[model samples]
Target: MKTAGGDAAAKRRAGERAAEEVEDGTVVGLGTGSTAAYAIEAIGDAVADGLEIRAIPTSFQSRQLALEVGIPLTTLDAVDRVDLAIDGADQVVDDPDATAHGTLIKGGGAAHSREKLVDAAADRFVVVADPSKLTARLDRSVPLEVLPDARTVAADRARVLGGEPTLRAAERKDGPVVTDNGNLVLDCDFGAIESPADLARDLSAIPGVLEHGLFVGLADATYVGTDDGVEIRAY
Candidate 1:
């Protein structure tokens, strides 16, 4: 495992490498989380250096960060298509045959509902992360956004899929963590996932599942920051 400072530095390097894809007069998709926050800052700096770009943010947190960095903001509804999306992943598995972006487990920050939307809307989606985030297989719990009223139904479905579902709770506030879309998040632990695409389809078919963290066929490429240098993996 990398030290805290090493992880931060790696994340910044990955973010900077991804930011190199941005160009003037492009519609970019800004993602959420700590790794993506570094990308947001880099994009902000790019804007300061006179890169004319409009961004659609995946979360409120990203929106604020983009504003602080001086990147112009836009809504998805106002754009025809996003040129590119640079985001981060919780876990990335190198499975070229599995999906276009390989297999990614995201939503650690609880913004996956919108993250999925923005990722799919882009012409190209790039994931930026440090080496610590890569895994031989996805073993982390997949996050599913559920409607408030459909929590029980979602949990039951998760159980049927061999997952132990737990409602994510707020750290500061009481009760469940609510998404920006006014939904609850269920962290479903299925141990090591074998087929991420099949599981993603199954979870999507479930009623009241706003979105799940299994990002299939969305990643065009991934930039992994390493001690030696940045590693670019294309799918």
Candidate 2:
């Protein structure tokens, strides 16, 4: 079994590898989560070494980290286009038979809505992950950002789609978890997703659901951190 420290190191390796892809004089999309944090730090270090780039953060967490690392911040509306986006996935489907290998499920940090917006707008989107995140299929719980008043309706809709929807609860606080957009989150479990694209569309069409955590064709590549080194899979 891999130790916690080993997993962390693996995440760092993948994140830094993706960070190295960023070039000077370009706009980057900074992602959320622990793995993406390493990429943000690497970019910050690059900035300290005179790399000039503007970054659009996917969440409050990412924004704060960028500030601490000295990566210049910009808004999506302020930039003409995003050159590249680096993000972490909660689970990645690494199917060998498929043409591409970066099908992913994200939103563990409740930032998938903004992350999707930034990632989809970028010219290239790279995913960073450790070996533990890799799987033959995406069977993880899908996170849904729903309107505060429509939580029940959204859950019912998810259940109608043959999913078990549960309101995500805050760890340090009481009651359900609220997103950065002042919305509620529903984590729906649909065992062994047969078709991610179709499920994504179905969940998206539901009323009151602002966004769902099913990233289909957004990833251009994935850097999987291993004990030996980082494995790059192009999508």
Candidate 3:
């Protein structure tokens, strides 16, 4: 654990280290969010230093950042596989017996749906975060992308699964926040998520659910920034 400033520094360190995995001529999956911004910046720097790699960005924000940083960009339509994906997690659980088992609660930036797509397409998914993001039990809210017409049904399903789902409101504009895919996001909080994998499956079964934030068994590794240093955990 660290102060707010220390946490930011740790995030930068984790991002920097994760970028080391990017090799020349590899197609990378770029993730969104503040922590992932660091990875994008590092990748951009690598490109300046002569690294030859193409990238698939998970969100508009990530895509814009990649362009600004000078990383060559591509689209999922143009590429079938990603060699690596570096992303951030709202919450990360390390224990195998735990409900999540490498599960994550993302979408703070409303990009989890796209992030999940890119992550799943990658051969390796690496999560980079400050130590504080790690937890024994996931207590953060799960973000679910739902079809506009099925918003009510999604909320109903969430309640049945023991969660309190709320439609996320946009801070800068009127009405609810809309995802890049033009869907609504339901931020569901099921206290202490005793079985994240089960909940994930249940969420996916819903007809209107496009994607949920629970990333069960997808992370190949994590780089956690700590007061001591960066800790590498490979699953």
TM-score of each: 0.95, 0.96, 0.95
> Residue by residue across 1-235, what tens digits does model 1's lDDT show?
1223338888888988899899899999999888888888888998998999999999998999899889999999998989999999998887555433367999988999899999999999999999888877889999999999999999999999999999999999989999999899999999988888889999999999999999987888899887767899998
Model 2 global lDDT (CA atoms, 0 to 1): 0.92
| Cα lDDT tens digits for candidate 2, 1-235 | 1223339989999999999999999999999999999999999999999999999999999999999999999999999999999999999989878533577899999999999999999999999999899888888899999998899999998999999999999999999888999999999999989889889999999999999999989999899899989999887
Top lDDT: which candidate number?
Answer: 2
Which residue pairs come into collision in candidate 2?
A: none
Per-residue CA lDDT of model 3 for 62-154, tens digit only, reads 999999999999988898679999999888997766545677888888899999989998999999998888888888899999999999999
On a 0 to 1 TM-score scale, where does candidate 3 land against the true structure?
0.95
Regions more than 4 Å wrong, model 1: 1-6, 95-101
RMSD of each: 2.3, 2.2, 2.4
TM-score of 2: 0.96
How much lDDT does each candidate structure score? Answer: 0.89, 0.92, 0.89
Runs of candidate 3 with Cα error greater than 4 angstroms are: 1-6, 96-99
